[model samples]
Target: MTYPPDPYQPPDPYRPSDPYRPLDPYQAVQPPPPDPTPSYPPPYTPTSPAPSSGSGYPPPPPYGGGPAYGPPPGYPPPAKSPFGPPGYGASYGPQNTSAMAIASLVCSIAGVVTCISAPVGVVLGHLAKRQIRETGEGGEGLATAGLWVGYILTVIGVVTALFYAAIFIWAIAEGTNVTTTF
Candidate 1:
């Protein structure tokens, strides 16, 4: 068969390989962006005054000698405080050292003769020492000295009594007349 004298319409004249390469007529070209913003705060608000301090702290409390500055509507004032304890700081000093001293004095006679009373004197002397400690007193050495003295005296008295008793018995056993004056 014979070919047609001219082929179909020619190809596009504006292709990328053309002598003057053209941007697509349908698209737009734009420039790049600039730099950033400034540094700072926004703002502030207002306030009120104090009832007493003008800036607002509460007031100091009141004082007096009588009832209230005007008394309540009718209530009485508070009662006066009383002194505390049995003696209420009377003398404000240590107790007497005489407890042990008196016990020591009693021990002299009791220790020298009666064996039973001698132990009582020693117990009293110990109690006196405890009293001095509990009461911040002056009987420390006094009571100790008294107790030992009483104990020693008791020992001496007992030994002397036994000695005399032995001697008296020996006298009678030897057929001698034994007479004792109290």
Candidate 2:
């Protein structure tokens, strides 16, 4: 004996002739017939080389040997600069500081803190002043200040080191001359 169809059972796609088969909503709604005219762009055709202008100057060679006048087909336009078009005059004043002068000041300040870079500061200061004289950059006062600070610090460091060395030698000499008796 054949069993009756269950109400909750899903319809089978293979059994199309079944009396209880569910109708497909998509089958009734066929796709609209294709339009007679297509919306595609026109076919591309290569053009001949561009004629040079009558001004006597030769036309510039095409970039990458692709096109003679404009960019190759399907390419986007060139991007614009964020700073606007070229040929605009300075928007701000001359704020360019000398790199060597800045370095000299930094080294001098560091030497003041660590007590070792004083000589480097002096050398850089002299170089910075020479560069400023030639290039006419700013920061001349900073270079001079760095030079004075470095010189003073270097002399103090040397004198302090010598004074300590002399005291150490004196202590050693005194110790050797002393006699210890049991």
Pick by lDDT: which candidate is best?
A: 2
lDDT of 2: 0.75
Question: Candidate 2, residues 87-145: lDDT per residue as tens digits?
Answer: 66544568567888888888887886788888799999999999999977889999998
What is the C-alpha lDDT profile of model 1 across 1-182, one tens digit per residue?
Answer: 33332222233344443436676788554433332333222121234233465554444445563464553533445556685456655675656675665776487556665666676777778888778777777767777777887787778878888999999889789865556779
lDDT against the true structure, each candidate: 0.63, 0.75
Candidate 1 Cα errors over 4 Å, as ranges? 1-95, 98-101, 109-118, 176-182
Cα TM-score per model:
0.37, 0.48
The candidate that wins on TM-score is 2
Q: How good is model 1 by TM-score?
A: 0.37
